[model samples]
Structure formats: C-alpha cells, structure tokens
Target: MLVGTIMRKIKSRTWKKQRYFKLQDDCMTIWYKSKKLFPSLICVPLFPVSVSDVEAIREGHQSEVLLSIADEFPADRCFTLVFRGRRGNLDLVAESAEEAQSWIRGIRKLMENLENMGQRERLDQWIGDWFRKADKNNDGRMNFREHHARLFSFFQMADRSQSGTLEDDEFVLFYKMLTQREDVLRVFQQFSLDGQTLSQSDLEDFLRDGQLEGDNVQQHAETLIQRYEPSDTAKLLNAMTFDGFLMYLGSSEGSIFNPRWREIFQDMSQPLCHYFISSSHNTYLMEDQLRGQSSVEGYIRALSRGCRCVEVDCWDGANGEPIVYHGHTFTSRILFKDVVTAVGNYAFKVSEYPVILSMENHCSVEQQRVMARHLNQILGNKLLKSTLDGKAAVGLPSPEDLKGKILLKAKKLGGLEESFSGTADDSQTGEVSSGKSPPSYNLKDYSRLCLCVRLLVSYLNNIVFESPHSQKLTFISPVFLFPQKSKQRLSKELSDCVVYCKSVHFSNFKHSHIHSKFYEVASFTESKARRHLRDTGGEFVHHNCRQLTRVYPSGFRTDSSNFNPQEMWNAGCQIVALNFQTAGEGMDLNDGMFRQNGGCGYVLKPGFMREAEKTFDPETPQKRDGYQPVALTIQVISGQQLPKVNIKEDSIVDPLVRVEIYGVPLDQNRQETRYIDNNGFNPVWYDTLRFTVHAPELAMVRFVVEDYDKTSKNDFVGQYALPLRCMQQGYRHIHLLSKDGTSIPPSSLFVHIRITELE
Candidate 1:
C-alpha cells in the first residue's frame, strides 16, 4: 500500500476536529487541514522514529486503531506519543482494526528500514534544527562570547582549582553526560595531548572539521578563538579557553540525545550484581494484581523499557497447552505459548543484553511437554538451554557474555538429598517444588537452577513447597510459617542455588549485613521502603552497596499506584520493581533512570555503591575532599504552549511554577514562583528561587508547573527533573513531561540558572 493511504489523528478532548495526519515512507506528518480553507494552521514532523518507540498498537474500546506511545505508559486511552526528543505527538484514532493493523505493520517495517539506513542524514537534520534554536544571531555557527553567555553557566560545578578548564576526570564526566559511548568519547579526547583535559582548541578542531589534523585544524581553532574567546584573555599555553569548551558542548553533536549514546559501547562485563537490572513484578497482569487481565503486552512493555527481568506464572489450561495468569484468581488468562512467542520476538529488539525469564511453574505433566515444545519452537536459539561457555563459571556470567540469551529462573523438583547435591530427583525433577505441577518436559533434562527464594512469592496463593498454599516450603506452616521476618536460616540446598537473587523480607537493615561475598536480595512494599528512606537510610545504603534489594508497591495499592523510585535509587537499592500498568511521578522517575546507557535496563552502580569494603552512610556521608555547598539561583521567566489545565472545561486556568531542591536535610527544600492568572497559553512568572545545597552530586532540582485551585488541590500540568551536577546554568529551556512520563512538546518553561559557592 502507498504511504499516507490511510492516515489519522485522534480527535482532541476539547476540540471537535483534530489536525490532519499523513504517513510517508520516512516520517509521519500532522497538519491542520481545515474545510474553510484559508490556510493550514499547523504542520509538524515526527521522524527518526523506529519500532522501539512504539509501546503498543491494538484495537481499543474507544478507537479501532489504538497506538499507545512506547514507554510513556499513559493512564487513559488518549495520551501523546513522546520519543527521540521530539515534541509533536498525537493520540490518534482510526476507522477500523484492519486499517490500524495495516498502519502499524507498515510503520514497523519503515522503522526496521530506518534502523538499517538514514541514521547519518537524520542526525544531520537534527543538528541543523538544534543549531537554529540555539543560534540567536541566525549565523551558521554559535559564538560563545555573547550568544553562549548562559550556555555553560554551570561551569563552577565541574571546574576545580578555578583553572577555567576542566581536567581529565571532569572532561570525562562532561562527555559521559552527553554520551556513554566509548568511541565518541575517544574521538573527543584525541584532540588533547596525554588526554589530561579538553581545551577550546581541541573542541574547535573536532567540531569545525570532525578531525584534529593538518594545518586546517589550527586554522579553525584560531578562527574560533578570534570569534568567541573572551575579549580579555590574550593567549593560553596549550588548553582550550573556556569559550571553546562550552561552545562545542552547545552544538548538536554534543546534545544529550546526539545518537552517540545510542551506540553499543557500554561495559557490560561487570558481574550481574554490579549493575541495577530493570525488573517488573506481575509482568503478565495489566491492572490490579488480584483480578487484572493477563496479556503478553505486559512482557512487551517491560522489555521495551529495558526491563531485563520479567515474571511469568505458568498454570494449567483447559486445553492441552499451558496458560499464564494469576492462579486461582478472577484474572483472565492468556496462552503460555503466546507469551513465550511475544518474548522471543521483542526480547532483544530494544537491547541486546541478556534477559531473565522468571517463571512460576504449575502446569500438569501432559501440558508440560506442550509448554516445552512451544518454548523450543518459538524461542529457538534465544533461550538459554545450558551455560553459555559450556562449563559453569564460578559466579554468574556477565551480561556481555550472555548477550542475546534468555535465562530461565524457576524452582526444580528435588528432595533434601538432591537439594544438597544441587541436582534434580527423578520425581518430576526440574519441576518446581510445588505439589503436582510438572515442570516443562524439555527442561526435565537440565539440572534445576538453584535459586534462593522466600517461602512464598505472594501471601495470598503463591506457590509453596509440597502444597501451593501452605505459605511455607515445609510440609506444614508451623516451624517456619511466619519465619521471624529475619533472614531465615536456610538449608545448604536452598542457599546454594541462589547465586543472584536471594529473596528475604526487609524488616530492617541492621541484621541484613554480610561479612562474606554473599548477596541477600530483600523485597518490601513501597511504604516500607519509604520508612527506611526516612528512618534507617544509612544502614540501607551500606547494605545495598554490597547486596541487592527489590522494592514493590504495597498490597493496599489495589489500583497499582507506584512510588517515586528515586527515593529507593538514592539508597543504592537495585531491582526496584514497578507495576508496569501504572503511570505517575513514580513511573516517570523509573523511566528516566533507565533511559540512559542505551536503555539496556542495566546501569553500573556509582563508585560509592561498588565499594564493598566501605560503609557509606546516606544521611551522614563523610564529606568528600574538595566538596562544598553550592549557592544556586534559578529564574523562572515564562512558559510556551502552557496547556490549559482542563481540556474539556472552558474556564481559563491560573498557572504557577514550583521549583524544588532535593538534597540534604530534606526539609525546607522547596521554593516556587507566584501564580500567573488567566494565562494558560503562556504564563509569565519571572520569579527567582534560591537555595543552599550541599554537594551537587547528592542533589537534584525538579521543576513543576501546576494550575492553581483554591477550593481543591492544585493539579499538575507537567514537570522536569535533573541532577544538580548535570544541570547547565544560564538561559535554558526545560522541557516538561506529563506525570506519566510522556514529553509535553512545544510546552516548555524558559529559565536562567547559576550555581556558585557561597563564599
């Protein structure tokens, strides 16, 4: 079919008609095609998009063609598509399922093609667009003297010794913010001798010609110095003047989304425990864990968001094949084979890193063969049948070594003796220790992977030993049923298989300590996590520095509300599992953290976290050498496309901007701008907010736009959050995102910021 043959944009909530939608081979175009025909009102382009950006596309109750934006996880049926730093997104609808399917298929094919080709040209176009936006003088190039006065304004944060130049580590930190790709960083570092630090000459050389050689490099460097070097400084010894460093970073090539970060250069050779792996609990359920419909889309959403670990509950079905769902609940069930098929297709599409298929087996012996056949047929080589290197290593393999592989984590049938030997018994061996539920037939040959797990996966109907509902692994629930919330003393059989995940309840952090190389992974509700964040945070940090922990929402959250994951991350806790169906500030922060390092869903722990020998307290952390409190000033000027608080209500909204500083002492961390009345389109506040924050590395600044409501709580419009250390001072455009994490394009807050020491 020809491109643009069938095009659509969702009807707006407040408007009678939406913009015109047209599909082309390379991109999608949305424009105002009015019947009155004076002229078109709007024309926007969404390009450089790929299959990875699509969260889901299926027939919806409201629209036949429902295309959900990937990763945004919009709460309702209608939400915008946000991807690749672009702003124009439409909550589109179509006439029929056939039409939507055709469009989805066509776009996916185009996305595949885009991946294979057109990257350089797309990057060039992106560069040109960004250059135009940053260039105030309309010149082809940016001048750092006046045009970039505020661009590198946060210079003090990274510049030590006041040398006006960032040394080796500082330069590397700067480049890491822009990109994590080694090749890109290598190219930028080549301009300097000994790679001590980058200078203006080095930057000018690389930006001007993308090379640092011949007389041309010096000529370009000199031209840049003449154009942007401070009117005062005469000459520098061998370093790039501050002007050149800032100017180069302001260019498109240095943009945070400059495609270099999309490269595969991250070091994945670290042990599995060394990185924070994205995971999802109840990965098959789309709503309440109790009674939600179980679909393969859950796996799709989690995996697409770089979630390396996904949960699957295998139960017997009426048919010969097995089914996946919350057992003995009102929740709907989906075919186990279908779930496996979906996993195989989408597992490595976003990230080539290893995937962990966390399985809870409960199928009958007859259906177990069907399950195995389905897994072997659908998953093919993607499934991990045996150890990658043929021989088992001493520790868990690195993600790099297991790339493009999927490892199954499930219980195997064994007695007290077999468990001691770490081998499977003939009694439905490879089958989980549950009653009667047979493990997959194909997997019967493989020895049971020893996994350390808690007594129950869930309090209500989780798989138990001997019986699936006894609440404990023993024959009865007396001796160990409520197992004193401490690390229950497990037999050698249970603790040995637990190479990675050693599940236990997180009652407190004091007793969870370990002197050996053992890792004990603890799970808790969000409320408990928050309590720890408030009360025993120091011990938690010390514990998480060496061990792993998993935090999920409380059972009381029937609607599946998520908590701000940053609170957990701040404590160095890994595996902060979220309910993939929910969207709020909590999920937004979750998406933000995993969005970096190529979204492989694994991020190496910070230096403090990797230091196993150190006892780093989160609250009373020993002040690092050469660190001081920063006096920060942020000016809130105005907002663009300040969307109306209520799209359905005609009443004009009074909007205000709230700037929050998150750092030590937690209290007194908030400041805001005065409200601007009746200016939903463009509010001008022009208010200044200031604060004293200790150590930029331990802090972050959050910007929130809200609609003032005296009778009720103020409603949130959008927000943006960035670590204080990564903030670039001067005049900056802070792009806003909805609570669900979708980008609110063209809707931005203009602000000026400066960071300096109080002295």
Candidate 2:
C-alpha cells in the first residue's frame, strides 16, 4: 500500500488531524504545525531490539534512568526506528523519527563506553549467547511464534491474550504497556500491533506501512488551555497577588477558609481602621464595645477592604437646630451647633476620614429650614476654610452652597438652592443675568412661587431628598406649585436644566411623562449644561434617571430608626431629620454626609464611633448627652363663679365651678379630705368622691355637680381634695373601667393634665 493510503487509513481510525510523512534514508518524519523530532538523538541502540529484550533490559537496570528518559522525551509524540548494522537488534521508540535517530547516537555512545571498559566485542558475543539459548529451533531467523513463546514465560502477567506469535507492533505495544502504562498510548499501541515480537526488517515494514495509531492529545490540550485562559477562575487567580490571596479567599468563598480568615483579611487590608458612631439617646457606646463595633468604621474598613456604603440619620430642632437623635421625643437636646462642634472635634481627633455621611430628616418644614440655616452657618465656614486653607472637612453645606463642596447630602428638598447657588448675592446676579429672579424666598409664601423655585433648588450637588413614601425624589428644577398649573412648565424647565442637575425629588412622578420629555429635549438646542451632571443626556444617564430620588409619603410620621440612607441618596438629599432613638444606635455612616440627630444624645457604643470613623474618614462624630427639656407651667385663672348644687334622694349632683389644673397630678384617693371655712359659715357639702371619678390611673382629675331635684331653686357647693401621684416613674397608660370591666373612653367631661417634669 502507498504510505499516503496507509496514513489516511490511520488518521480515519484514530480521530486525529491528518498528518503527512516524508521518508528519508535514515528515518521517517511526521509533520504537523510544528516539526518535532522523536527519540531525541539518544538511545538509538535500543532501536531494532526485540520488545521482550527491551523489557528485560529495563527490568534488570535502574528504573530511575528510564523515568528520567521518559521525562526528557515524553512518549506522546514519539516514533520508532530499526537499525540494520547493530550486533543485536534494537527497537527505538521516540516522539518522532528524528528523535529515533538521536537514540541511535545514544546507542553509539553506549557502545563506546563498553569499548572503553574493554568489553565492546563482548556486546556481539553476549547477544549470540542469548540467541543460541532462545533460538531452540535454530532456523537462523527466529520466527514470530518462537519469539512469542520464548518471551511469554518472562511476561506472563502482561500477556492477557494467548497469541502464539507477536508482531513488531505487538512487541512495541507490550514493551510500552509494561514501561509507561499510559492508557492513551497503550490504546494506540494495541491497535497498531499484528501478532509477533518484531525483528529489524519487520519493524521497518510496519513503519513504512503506517500501521501505528495517531493521537490528537497535543491539539486537545492546547485547545483546553485557550478556552479556560479567560475564565473567572483564571482571572481570579491572575489578579491575586501574594498579599491579595487571603482577601480573595475571604471574598470569594469565605466559608471555605478558617475563621481566622478575618484576621488574615485584616492583615491584608489593614484591619485597625476607625469609624464614628452617630449619636442617639439609646445608643450606649459601651454596648458597642460589647457588640464588636461594627459602625461606619467597620463598614469602611470592610469597604476600604471593600464595603459599599454606610448610613446615618438627622433631625431638625428648634431654631433650625438639626441634630442627630433617634426618638420621636428628643430625650437629649442637641443643637445643630453642638453636632458641628462634635464633628469638628472628631475630625481633629481622627486621621482617617469618612467617605460618606447619609442623613435622614425627621422634622417639619419650618423646623427643617431652621436646621438648614444652622447647618449652613457651621458647614459654610468649614467649606470656605477647606477651599482656602488647603485642609479637609466634610462640610454639611446648606442646599444653597453644595456646589462648592466635594461631598454634601440633601436629605430633603428643603435647602438645596442654598447649598448650590453659591450665595444669595451670586444667585441674584445669576437671576439678573438670566432675566429671572427667584421669587421672594419665604416659608409661608413658598407655595405661590413658580415651579422654577423648586427646580432650581433640586440642582444642588450631593443633595439628596429622602422620603418614607414610594415616590422617588429627583431634580425638579422648577417644581410646580400645583400639578395642574405648572406640570408642562416644569417639564420644559427640567429638559432645559437637566444637564445641570443631579437628581429630581418627587412623590410618584410619572414615568411616561419623563420619557416623553427626555425624547423631546434630546434634540433641544440650548445653552449646553455640564454633560457630567448626574441626571441627564445619554443612555447611561437615562437608565439611571428612571430611578426617582426623593419620595415623602403624605402621612409618614417622624421617628428615629426607620430613616433610610440609601433612600436619601436616591432622593438627592443631604440633610436628614432623625429622631434621637431610632437611627442613632446601630447605623453605619460612611458615604460622607453630616448627621444632626435633632436632639442631644450619645453613641451607644464608643467602639462603634471608632469603627465608623475608620470606615468613613473625616466624619464628625458627636455626642449630645447634655440636654434639658423645656418647662411649661399652668394655673387656675379664675375661682369666682361657685354655683348652687341641688341634691335629691338616690340621685347624683353635678359640682359647680370646676377647676382644671394644667401640668399637675391629682390625688384621687384623698377624695374625702376637706377644707374648713374661715368664718364658720354653714357647712358646705363637697362631693369629693364624684370629683375624683375620672380616668382611673391618669394624673387628671374632674369635678362635677349633678342637680337631682329637677328644681332650679336649691344650691349645692363645695371645696374638694386634690388628686396626685407623686411617685409615678414614667408615663403610664390610664384605664377607666366600668363596673363590668370594660374600659371607658375619653369624654367631654374629662380632666386635663400637662407635662410637669422636663428632663
């Protein structure tokens, strides 16, 4: 058969890419993309040797030497050769024919070594000795059957088949099977065999006929390498530096690592970071120590190691005093001023600064304005200094002055214009230059201004407006006072200024309208606003804009803990109003905004403060523990009208001239106590029992005189005992039960009480 036909037949059976070979005087060479030689120019003496003989040589000699040869010349792409001039036949196996020739050279060296030892001639004599013993029939040429029978006894364990003869290919296969034991190579070797141990001429005939099976393992391995090189595992391993290995381990599969992985991660990312604990009355700084301070610092340290963000809350107090308190009632009075001082002090104390401070607002509009003004005053100075003095401070800029600060927050739409507009004078100048002036800024008349007032207000940088409602806040540059009148105008104005604003604040703003407006203004020709503004002008911006920024539910009540920082960020709000108790105790504040917990309070955990500081550097951590409650007093203005009360048998009489005490408790148990008239006048009957009959546990008391006689002539009058509970600790629930045990609801004829003790 032609070599090409034989090669084609081998290729078709082996499932390998076709390879062509060239026959040379010395050897046959196979070519693929690259030209690789087989036998490695060494061990050529082994060529033309019987497979059984090679096995015997390998078994009787040092196995390490053969392993070293295998390592040096892998058998996957090896070829075999048969030399005609050797004293005894040697079988050569190599990756390619060229390597087989190299093996011939190795055999020459072995022969030279034998000669140096004065045993070169003994090589032929030794083969002759083995031949005489093995060739029992002595036919001069050992037939395949005789060789196979002779070798069978030596390799009985490997010969699974009881074939009488072994072909050259069979002998090679048996040799490799015993030596390498490679499943792939053994399969190829098995398919190439045809019965008996090969002689020199037989081995040459087999190669020329292309009977050996080819393998595509090299191609497959290269393809596998190509496919997985860009996989996630590869990328992960690639990005991992020696130091980053532990972090990658923790981040990717933390459960697989030891608990000490946290320590390892810390070592990798500098775990000794600081964080600030936002203040709250219920926040026990010591508790944080026990709880393992996981404040903004914990978040930041995690983030600097890579955490996302942190959270904090704010509230507006009297005099626009924005503070950081958590409860509905400020147990601790904290002025925005105190918060500013605390933050400044904290900044001075800590080197690492907070990256973000999310503020939640819980205050009325009027109160918010007051708080905004306070924040403006305190933050303005810091901002100016940072801009001028080359220092850093996370200034809590008013909504009007936010444009200049690197970081600012807008918890609500309240003070955005103040933060972004530079100054009132600058705003005025801009207004004049633009042929418009913001309508007179007044809290009461604000409802009358055009939507532009609100639109302009929403453009402040870093401002966020958070709402408990579902609608998101956005930059409604000209917020329509009434939807009916200014929706179109506001929409148009938004399109014009979309490039200038960050986000719009709205409660359930329509999406279709926004989409339509975007389409309409996409082609609008006007003065170009900054393209980088967060809200408008491209696919990415539009995709982000679909999300609303601020949404305040209509009936939402102000409390501390429910404040959401992410919501505020979405709303473009910077200042957040928070009750002292809720958001103060266990919240993270890292993304860089000033927090004023409306009333004075302290952080529950001192360690948490440190943690927050580490997480969000430059955050102004403050403690507002020193606060006094407001005092209120009330008195009876008049006692002149004492009317006559008439009493009948078995009937109740209503008391006349009832006096209600404000901010005082009544002693219902002392109903029978009486007062003696100074002039010894007729004894007046006082129904003290009936007077004490009000809501049972409340401090309130009531006096009533029921006229039972049905005649308006008789008079019933009296002075009664006062009712009070001096030992009450806190506010108690009052339950007025009927004789049957059902409770009585409040009535018109009830008592009044005021808060007497403010602490």
Ten consecutive residues with minimal summed lDDT in candidate 1?
Answer: 444-453
In order, candidate lDDTs are: 0.57, 0.26
lDDT, candidate 2, residue 362? Answer: 45
- Best prediction by TM-score: 1
Model 1: CA > 4 A from native: 1-266, 360-377, 412-427, 430-522, 527-539, 622-632, 648-650, 661-668, 691-700, 755-759
Residue lDDT tens for model 1, 1-759: 232332335533333343344453325322234333324423333333333355344433222113223222232323334343212234554445565566657656755654444323433333344334445554444433322222264445544456665444543343233322233234446665546444555655564444212356566566555544443443354355443443333342232232344444458897676677788877888787667868776787677778888878887788587889876566888889778877897799789888877666566556666776777678778876654565533455678988898765544232223433556343432322232222232221212221112233333244334475555432232323233332111222222233334343344555566332233355666787777877877677667766656777675576767776666776777778788777766666556556557778887766665666655445654443344567888878777556556744345668899987655454128888888877654567778988887645556567889999889999889887655655655445676787766664446676666777855
**Candidate that scores best on lDDT:** 1
Q: For model 1, which pairs clash?
A: 10-92, 55-70, 199-240, 200-240, 450-497
| Candidate 1 lDDT | 0.57
TM-score of 1: 0.60
Candidate 2 per-residue lDDT, tens place, 484-578, comes to 32111111111111111222322122343343221111110011112212233222222223221222211123232334332222222222222
